[model samples]
Target: MYQGYLKYKTVIAELDSAIQLRINIVLFLASVYLVLQTSVGFKNPTYGGAPKRLPEKINCSASNRGFI
Candidate 1:
């Protein structure tokens, strides 16, 4: 009975350690994915995978003259 108990404890400990290692790996991968996703989003506002230029600034001074 003592030997069986020791074997069972070791098995449980090994399984627990394996599970923890897998969880850590998954969390690390998820963090890396999130970082990459955010970086890609920052590169393109339109989500079209191509970097686009910002809209040209309006010439408010010139347009206001027309209204005046």
Candidate 2:
């Protein structure tokens, strides 16, 4: 408010505090989402499946090929 700003510096300080609170809220939500995803992401079937393989474990021979 123009009246508040002209009278004292408290108005600007209050606005700055409100802005910081909003920013802190956003950051907290983002951090919570990141932690949740990181924890749940490991439980996904794609991650737990046997797709994680080494080149040596694969059988690339003709007999092992399917409809190739």
Candidate 3:
């Protein structure tokens, strides 16, 4: 939330420089985790599964993916 970011800024500003450094390190790690989590893709868009691999293994006729 926007409020949460503002609150974090205020709190970090009040911390001693040493503690602020530690908090910033944690914030950086958390941001990286959030980015990786959000950027990840899935095999099935509607219901996630193993990611599609190189040279897709979907078994189907040449013209249609659903053909047997």
Candidate 4:
């Protein structure tokens, strides 16, 4: 009975360690993804630009009006 209990404890300890390692890995991946997303967003202007297409004349007018 004592030996069985010891085996069970060892298994539980291993499972706990594995779970902690997995959680750490997931958090690291999430942090990496967030950093990559932020870098991409800042480097790519289209990510924050208008979604609709504007006419060239309107763009020129806006530029002339100092709204650009």
Candidate 5:
């Protein structure tokens, strides 16, 4: 009976250690993913292309009022 109890305890300990290791790995991966996403956003503010803007001087007088 004592030997059986010892074996059970050992198995439980191994399982607990495995679970902790898995959790640590998942946390590490999540942190890495967040860092990469943040870096990408900072590196490229506009994902599509440069912003469009009106020319300094417009040939049309009515268009100068900013009616667009």
Candidate 6:
């Protein structure tokens, strides 16, 4: 595998800048689409049938001072 990579290293380096930019743009768009899908899933109430419940007591104690 190392030898194969070494052989193609120069070929990879010689790729046109325009091609690299297009590849990068495609990857960025893909990541953005994935994030949007995830956020939409979270916001869609139809996905999770049950609503989450909050705890009755709120704890804002200082752990370092041994308070709870």
Q: Against the true structure, whose lDDT is highest?
A: 1
Error of 6 at 67 (Å): 54
lDDT of 3 by residue, 34-68 (tens): 66555653533433344545797766676676444
Task: For model 4, give the 10-residue run with minimal summed lDDT.
Answer: 43-52
Across 1-68, the per-residue lDDT of candidate 6 in tens digits comes to: 99999879867776766688999999999988777766665667554434557677755569745773
Q: In candidate 1, where is summed lDDT lowest over 10 consecutive residues?
A: 42-51
TM-score of 6: 0.39
The C-alpha local distance difference test score for the whole of candidate 1 amounts to 0.81
Q: How accurate locally, in lDDT, is each candidate?
A: 0.81, 0.74, 0.69, 0.78, 0.78, 0.72
**How do the residues 2-67 of candidate 1 rate in per-residue lDDT, one tens digit apiece?**
999999999999999999999999999998877776667655554433456779987789666797
Question: Which pairs of residues collide in model 4?
Answer: none
Ranking by TM-score: 1, 4, 5, 2, 6, 3
Total backbone clashes of model 4?
Answer: 0
- Tell me each candidate's TM-score: 0.61, 0.55, 0.37, 0.60, 0.60, 0.39
Model 3: residues >4 Å from true position, as ranges? 1-15, 41-68
Per-residue lDDT of 23 in model 5:
100
Q: Candidate 6, which segments miss by more than 4 Å at Cα?
A: 1-15, 42-68
Give the range where candidate 3 is weakest over 10 consecutive residues by summed lDDT. Answer: 41-50
Model 6 pairs whose backbones collide = none
Query: Which residue pairs show backbone clashes in model 1?
Result: none
Would you list the clashing residue pairs of candidate 2? Answer: none
For model 1, the stretches where C-alpha displacement exceeds 4 angstroms are 42-68
